[model samples]
Target chain A: MIRKALIPVFMLMVTFPIALLLLLSFGKSWVYPNIFPDQFTLQHWNDIYQINSELLMVTLKSIGISLGVSSVVTLLSFFSSKHISYSVYKSRWLFLAYIPYVFSPVILAATLQFYFTFVDVSGTFFGVILAQLFITYPFGVLIFSNFWNPRIKAIAELSNTLGGNSWITFYKVVLPLSKGVLLLCFFQVFLISWFEYGLTALIGVGKIKTLTLSVFQYIQEANIFLAALASCLLIIPPMILLYLNKRFIFTNQQTI
Target chain B: MTNQLLDIQNLSKAFEDEHILTQTSFFLQESKTLSILGKSGSGKTTLLKIIAGLEKQDNGTILLENNDITTLSAHKRNIVYLYQDALLFPHLNVFENIAFGLKLRKINAQEVKNRVTKMLYDLELQKHIHKMPTQLSGGQRQRVSFGRALIIQPKILLLDEPFGALDVDTRKQMQRLCKETLKQYKITTLFVTHDLKEALIMGDQIGKMQSGVLKTFKNKEEFLNDPSTGIKEEIEFWKNIHANEE
Candidate 1:
């Protein structure tokens, strides 16, 4: 009975804060130490669509970067993992693949600063994307390696003997079979790049101004309402992506 | 010699210092079933893989239709190997799985459909034609796998204990289906099994592997009389059971 009661209690625990944040975003005069706002208005929501709203610009920018990072990471990982899984060094490569995570993204970005300048992508949007790629592509590799098991190897051989060359076998056999896991990997790496701050902060030198930077800017300015609004904006895309992905994962294999 | 479809000559493979196959030689005739019996780790699977071009032998020549095909890649070898597990591609339905090879050959969509439809009925899997591999029972899945392999009309079919994973009843049913299909197609088959009875039932000629050496018998009488497989003792033991029942 207690456990059953705890379910709704836990729901309230998560939702209550989100409800408060929603109210604050629209609240005109929310005062300290008050459970409810002094006044409510729609000005902040209206501010989102103004001709030159920085928040709107930052949100669009973040979406663009997130989409790019997800595409490059998922694609590169798909091809790389296919080779790695079939390669003799399949499991052994995980040690090298995982080394990126050993350093905080900030630390890694800092160390790679000189190399970034040498390639002339330093402090640029491209530089930040590249940095995020370095840190997150390994995740795709790791996830994809698990997807490419001995059973998959057998299937690949089956396809080959059925008269498929490497290209035909990969696109027809591996790519289609792993589509669900690959889509899942896409969403996962999207969220990683979307939520990332430390790497962008260091490598981008703050010129790249992602939505996370906007939230941080509001926090520094002590505008808690706008900060909450920005945080709310940041959370919505992932929540939606996850709800759709939940249906997909349930419809497909459970291994992921 | 002229009728031989696959001739494996002086095949040798080793892992580190351990010899898995040493100077192994065998000749399989066209349209014949050759059953190989071996204990686990006796290089049965390795030999089959080598024949299918999925494994490299340290030394050997694989002659197919009198051509030295030892260096041919797996896709070009025209040999299909079925594993112990059915390994039906989970992404495809029964019909699609059956038609996978034809699609790869770029056969027209109508022909692919007609052939796959006919095969589904022939395999008695008409009801599950649209069902995913995961939705089928073990026997049904293996039948789809068998259909998938046979539809390609490979020059050689390698079975590595393909029915080993099924229950006894399913195994027996699969064995019957396998024998029937192989005979119907006249597919040159090399079936590797650890079960003596399965070998005897499926084989036109039976061979046994001990350590890394393989020996084939000319007939069932020779196989039954051979001591290496302990078949003579096994038959005597069964006879005792029948006598005790009497």
Candidate 2:
């Protein structure tokens, strides 16, 4: 019972820093000697808007890239999972498909950097999206495959007997049944894409900028206020998306 | 016969070195039901799977209305197999699960709605149409499974112990419901069960299988009364098992 009570306390502890960052973004700065800032102002927030449009463009670009990566990863995972689940070589190929995810991100990125340079697609959005998709695709496949394999053949048979062709069975019967898993996959890929830094920085070079990049830049410049403000801004959109996702998706269903 | 919906000839199947079925043959006229009875490893489920095209037979031919479907892929055979556990898609509600086949066929919204609504009413699942599979009672989920399979109007329905997961009373109720629904639809069915009583109640003809060969009889009376067969021993085995359980 005490353990249960401590959980909420722990959660509050974890969230305190984020809350403090939000507070700091509203023009409040806390010095080490004092318990609280002497004055609270919105100067940092205003400074962000006034100083540069790069942040705004970067935010929008991050959203687009994340969405693009999520969609592509979802599609690739969906088909590959379907194939793996139904194929005769499921056990063998499934193990092979997981190799990319099991490898360290830095190693994978370094390997891809060599490959991307060779292919002449280095430092492009496409290159970053592709790299990220590879990282996220296995997770998608693993999630969907866990649900699809044992159930797909049975459901497909049921659909076919009911006058449904293969495509119809997939779209109507299989897809609807897999809605929960797909939503989960989408969110997972989105999160991975949004906060991903190592692969993006390595592959995207200096041309592409994301919110994570902006946060890193401000922190490097020793502007703790700006960095905290940027981190707060970076965190808001994903939190809102996650909130909406939890509210609307799954709808009381426990996804496998 | 012209009306014989399914005919199996010298069907045999092996998994690795273990023989599941050997030289098994059967015939089912349209709208008739057959039950396969056996012990746990007696290959009753394997037989059903082979007929449903989910499992391959090593050396036999399966004819669906005189059309060879022995080599047909499961998706092309249109033989619906219900699992012991109702494998209703967890993400879809009862109505949507039942409507899955129609939607797959690209049936328009109105027709799909009309058919699914009637099926829900027919199965007495109207109130639970919006409920997820997990929220349903075992009997309710089996009924949804039944409706999901029936809505597709398959060439033949293969039941792999559909009510096996329910409690005894609920199992009895589901069995009765299944019998009534099959009669109403006049759909050909092959039900596999280890329960002799269930087979007697649901099967138009009962085929007792031992090892891999099937010994078929026309009805319950012959199945129980045939002196040359091992029906008595099978019944005694079940009786002792149940008695021990009690």
Candidate 3:
């Protein structure tokens, strides 16, 4: 009885904030000391596609950037982690992977901003993508390095002896075995690139307005309704990813 | 100029200051299994690795069926090295795991299906063909591993204490199965083990490894007579238990 009773309460606690965000996005006259909004409207939601609205473009750009960064980072780091894991100086190499995270992403981006500007990629979409890779790539390596243990190495060797060339071994054995970890790395790095503000701001130079930046823009202008809508939009992709992770990765992980 | 199917001449290896294998050489005729008996760190694994082309020898030539495979990459060597752990790919079901090598060779789909199905039946795993690696028991997994290796028709199969992780009964069963299967296939094998009984049971040609040197006995009787092989001590120890019980 207690367990059943606590379940709904827990779910409500989790969903309450989401509900409030949705309500606030639709709210027209919510003021201090008001238990409920005096009125509700769809005008704020309509602003998403209105003429001259940056919301739609910014949302699409954020999706594109996050998807690109996550895909590249996941692939590069998967291979990089395997090599580093098997290297004689494994710990030394892993320590280097951790170096980027030693400072905050913001500080790291600031330090790297000059290098980005020097390369003539500053204030560009590609620039923000490059800047996010600096952070997410190392994070990916850290996560995937743990995936390559002695057993995994032995399995790869086993594949080779079974007449599998390097490509065959990777495509047939390693990749299939690494599915769960690969999905997890992609999702985590996606989240990292999605919410990244500092590096995006520093490298983008305010010319690139991602959904995250738009949320901040609305908040700065004291437009709470629009800010709430942007926040709601920001929450959608990760929620879908979480659902995917739970549905596919974790389910497959039970067997792995 | 030699009848040996697999030949190693003056194989030597070192790791930094420590020499793992020193001037080791052996040869096995076709369809023969050479069981190498060695304790931990006896350089047995290093020897096997070099032959399988998984590791490079500091100085040696490995000839497989009269071809110098000394510089061949591991995948091209057709020498399968089986570790103690079954190490089945977790994502693949039993059939897929067994078919893995054939698939890599791009064997036709129908032929791949027939061979894997036949191999599964031979390993008595047809009923569990769809089961994932995680769903199988330890012994079942090892059988699958064996099937996976054997399906490729390897030039030589190297067993590095492949039954080390099983319980006594399973080990015996696997030993019997391995013996029967190898005989049926006439596959040359290099079986490495620390277990005395296992070494005697698994190998047609028995050798003992100590301090990076391999001493392949002329015959089983010679191996048993050698004190350094430890069979006498093992026998004496067992006889004492029987005497005490009497």
**Which candidate leads in DockQ?**
3
Kindly report the root-mean-square deviation of model 2 from the true structure over all alpha carbons.
4.5
Query: lDDT tens digits, residues B1-246, model 3?
Result: 325898889999999989989899889988888999999999999999999888999998898888999999999999999999999998889988998999888899999999999888888888899999888999999999999999999989999999999999998899998899998888999999999999999999899999999999988999999999989999999999999999
lDDT of 2 by residue, B55-173 (tens): 77899999998999888777778788888878787667888888877776678999999989988888899999889888899899999989988887888999888888889999988
Candidate number 3, chain A TM-score: 0.94
Best-performing candidate as measured by TM-score? 3
Instruction: List model 2's recovered fraction of native interface contacts, to 2 decimals.
Output: 0.56
lDDT of each: 0.89, 0.82, 0.91
Going through the candidates in order, the fraction of native interface contacts each one reproduces equals 0.82, 0.56, 0.98
Listed models, DockQ each:
0.60, 0.41, 0.87
Which sections of candidate 1 miss by over 4 Å?
A1-7, A37-41, A86-91, A114-120, A254-256, B239-246
Flag the better candidate by DockQ, 2 or 3: 3
Model 3, residue B150: what's the lDDT?
94
Looking at model 3, the pairs that clash are: none
Displacement of the residue B79 alpha carbon in candidate 3, Å: 1.4
Q: Looking at candidate 1, what is the lDDT of residue A208?
A: 86
Question: Of the candidates numbered 1 and 2, which has the greater lDDT value?
Answer: 1
- Structure candidate 1, residue pairs in collision: none
